[model samples]
Target: MTQERISLFVDHIGPFDAQKIGVLRGKANSGLELLNGHNIEVVQGFACEFDRLERFGFSPGAKIGSDFGDLDMALVQITRSKVETKLLVAQAWDATRVGGRIVVDGQKTDGIESIYKALRKLGIEPDTLVKSHGRIFWFERDETRPFADWLEPKLKMPDGFATAPGVFSAEKLDKGSLALIAALPPLAGHGADIGAGWGFLSRAALGHEKVTKLDLIEAEIAALDAARVNIIDERANFEWADVTKTSGRFYDFIIANPPFHTERTANTDLGVAFLTTAARNLKPKGQFYCVANRHLPYEVVLNELFRNVAEIGGTSAFKVFQAAQPRRL
Candidate 1:
C-alpha cells in the first residue's frame, strides 16, 4: 500500500561524522554533511539499548545502522516493543513540520501489527507497506514543536539506563546474563568481561577479592551505561565497543556470556568472533570463560582459540565452558 508519510523526525545526534545524521547511521562512514545548515547528530545502538545518546556535543561513538543524514523526514527503527512503537509514533507525530512525515519499520513477529493497531487507536492514520514479511507504516501531521520538547521537561537519561522499543533487556536485567553472574568464579587482579551486557557479569566479578581492575566491554552504548552503574567502582573501566574489534592489553582472566544471535537468527559467527577474540585478548596462562546456548556450534572456535577447552556446566537454556591459553597474550 502507498504510505501516507515518508519519514520520521528524531534527535539528530550520534557518532561523530561529517555526514548528515541519516548517512551517519544508515549509510557509510565518513563524509561532510548536515541538515538545515546544521550538523545532524546520528546515533545508533544494536538492540536499541542506547542511552548515552542524550549527552550533547560532538559524539564520535554513535554507531550508524541506517543513514538518516539528509532526509527532510525522520525514521525510527523499532525491533523490540509496541510501547516503544507508540512512543516513537507519538514523538514523530508531534515533531513533524506540517506536511512532513515519519515512518516505523519492524518485523511482523516483533509485533508490527500491534504498532499498526495502536496508531489506529491514536486516531492517527498510517499508510501501510510490507517488506520481507516485516511491516512499515507512515503518517503525516501538522506543524508541531520540537518532539523532545513535549517529553517530560528536565528529563535526563539515567546512568546505567538506556532503552528503545523492542531491544532485548531494554527495561531491565537480561536473564541469561544474570545466570552467568551467579555462576562466575571470584575475580582477581585485572579482568575483562566479554559481551558484558549491561555490565551484569562485570558487576558480579567486582565482588571478588581480586579484579583490582575490570574492563567491561560491550558493543551497545545503552548496555555500557548499565555496566557503568552496576560496576560503579574505581577499578571499573567501561568500553562501548564490539568485543571482536578490541585492541587493548590482555587480562589475567576474561569472562563472558557471548552474544549468539542477531534478533532470532542463530549467528554462530558472532560467538566464534567472541571466542577468537577472547583467546587473542587474554593473558598467557590465564583463563577465558563463557556461557552460551547449548545448541550453538561454538566448539570449533573454542578449540581453535584456547590451549584447552572444557565444559564446566550448563542448564536447559545455557552451557558454561572454561578455556585456558598457554600462549602469551
Candidate 2:
C-alpha cells in the first residue's frame, strides 16, 4: 500500500483572530515538517499568511505570500465560530486543479453544517462527511472561479461607535460597558481597553484627562480596524491580538467588558484567561476593572487569580468587578 499524501493544513483561517498561541502552533509544526519531505510549498493566509508563519511560531522562516501555487489538497479547522465557509470554498474552487480536494472542519455549534450545505449552493457539495464533535466535509474543487463576499451585507453600526457584523455588542450600546464608563473612577495614567470591540471602552478610556495613552487590544480584524478611525489621537495604539494570549508592557489602568458566552454556551469565562493575561500586562499595583452579567461566578475566577477582587457596582442585569495585581516581591 502506498502512503497517503500529506495535505496543507491550518488550525484556523479567520480575519481578526488574535489567536497566535493556541492549537495553531501544533498544526503549523506538523504541516511544515511534512511539507519539507514533499516538493509542495504551502501558502497559509491569503495576503499576510507568510508574515505570520514565523511571527507566531507557525513556520521558522516564511515570508508573506501574495500568490497561490498549484495545490493538491488543503485542510482548515475552526472552533466554535462559523466563518464565511463559502469564501473558502470559492477560493479553493478557483485555486485548486480539477482533481484537488478542499477539507473544512468546524464544530456543529459553530455552523459547520450550514457551511457544508452552502457548498451545494456553489456546486461543490462534500463527497466525504465525518461527524463527531463537529463535521468534516471534503469535496473535489473545480479550478478557480469568482466568488461573492458573504460578509458584505452584515454591517454593524451605532452613533459614535465603530462596529462590524458578528462582533459582540456591535448593534447597540452595551449595558455593561456603559455602566463601567459611568462607574469608572476619575481615571488617570496610561491605560488600555482589553478586547475593545468597536472602540467603545477605548474611546471612553482615551477621553479621560488622566490617561496619557490608550492602548486598544482587539482580536477581530474588522473591529480592530474600526477602532483605528475612532481613536485618532497621538496617545492611541491599536493592536490585533487575542487578549487572552497577548503580551506587552504594563499599564496603570485596564478596563473591559469581557466576553462570558459564545455559541449558546453560558459562563465559559474564557475571560478568566484574559483577566490573568491582562494581569501580567499591567504594572505592579495596576488597577483592573470589567463588567459582566449578573449570574456569572467571575468572583471565584478573579479571587483565585488576582490579589484582590471587589464588586464596585451592579444593576439588575450586570455587575462590575474592580481588581488589582499585587506589588511584586
- Per-model TM-score, in order, reads 0.72, 0.70
What's model 2's TM-score? Answer: 0.70
Colliding residue pairs in candidate 2: 16-220, 16-221, 93-144, 94-144, 94-145, 189-210
Which candidate achieves the best TM-score against the true structure? 1
Name the regions of candidate 2 deviating beyond 4 angstroms. Answer: 1-57, 60-65, 68-70, 94-99, 143-146, 149-153, 160-167, 170-173, 220-222, 242-248, 261-269, 283-285, 301-309, 324-329
The per-candidate count of clashes, in order, stands at: 34, 6
How far residue 78's Cα lies from its native spot in candidate 2, in Å, is: 3.8
lDDT per residue as tens, model 1, 15-88: 22222223112211212122335444444564222333333233433643333323445555554555545555
- The positional error of residue 198 in candidate 1, measured at the CA in angstroms, is 1.3
Local distance difference test, per candidate?
A: 0.60, 0.62
Candidate 1 TM-score, true structure as reference: 0.72
Q: Which regions of candidate 1 are displaced past 4 Å?
A: 1-41, 47-72, 143-167, 171-175, 326-329
Write model 2 residue lDDT over 12-38, tens digit each, in one string.
221221111111111343334433433
